[model samples]
Target: MKEQLIEKFENDMKKRSYFLRLLLVIDQFFNVLFWNGSQDETISSHVGRRIKSGKANRFEKLLCKFLSKLESEHCKKSLGE
Candidate 1:
């Protein structure tokens, strides 16, 4: 029973981590798209700092690419493409 509980806890943690990452990607994407150019620069600088600080991970780049594609598709659809 104790082992089962530990397994379940680990699974939950993994799910939570994935969800948090998804939310972070969405938030960053929105900030990039909707913010003025100056604000976009701020966001870029913040991301640069994270990369410099060794806090950025490879998964984030992948997420960004995926989100960008989705955003493009959304825009195209909105334009009746």
Candidate 2:
């Protein structure tokens, strides 16, 4: 019974790790799509549409905030701030 519990815990951990990695990949994909150029308005409009249409998930909205923060930090670094 102890060994079975240990095995179950290990499986749960592995599942969580896999989910985290998937989220990271998704975030990276959106970051590239929305931040690869100077088309900020385009990206914003697209996201707004997604939100209005109920096509965006909570995770995607959170990812938008994360990507925006990353972009701000990058800009600050570039400007030597």
Worst 10 residues of 1 by lDDT: 72-81
Q: List per-candidate RMSD values in Å.
A: 14.9, 15.0
Instruction: Candidate 2: list runs displaced more than 4 Å.
Output: 1-16, 37-81
Q: After superposition, how far is residue 34 of candidate 1 from its true place, in Å?
A: 0.3
- For residues 1-81, what per-residue lDDT tens digits would candidate 2 score against the true structure? 999999987986787787775664564466457655232223444454455577877765665566568675332232210
Whose lDDT is greatest here? Answer: 2
Q: Candidate 2's error at 81, in angstroms?
A: 19
1-81 in candidate 1: lDDT tens per residue? 999999987986787787775665665566467543232233434444444567756754454445457675332232210
How many backbone clashes does every candidate have?
0, 0
For each candidate, the alpha-carbon lDDT, in order, equals 0.51, 0.53
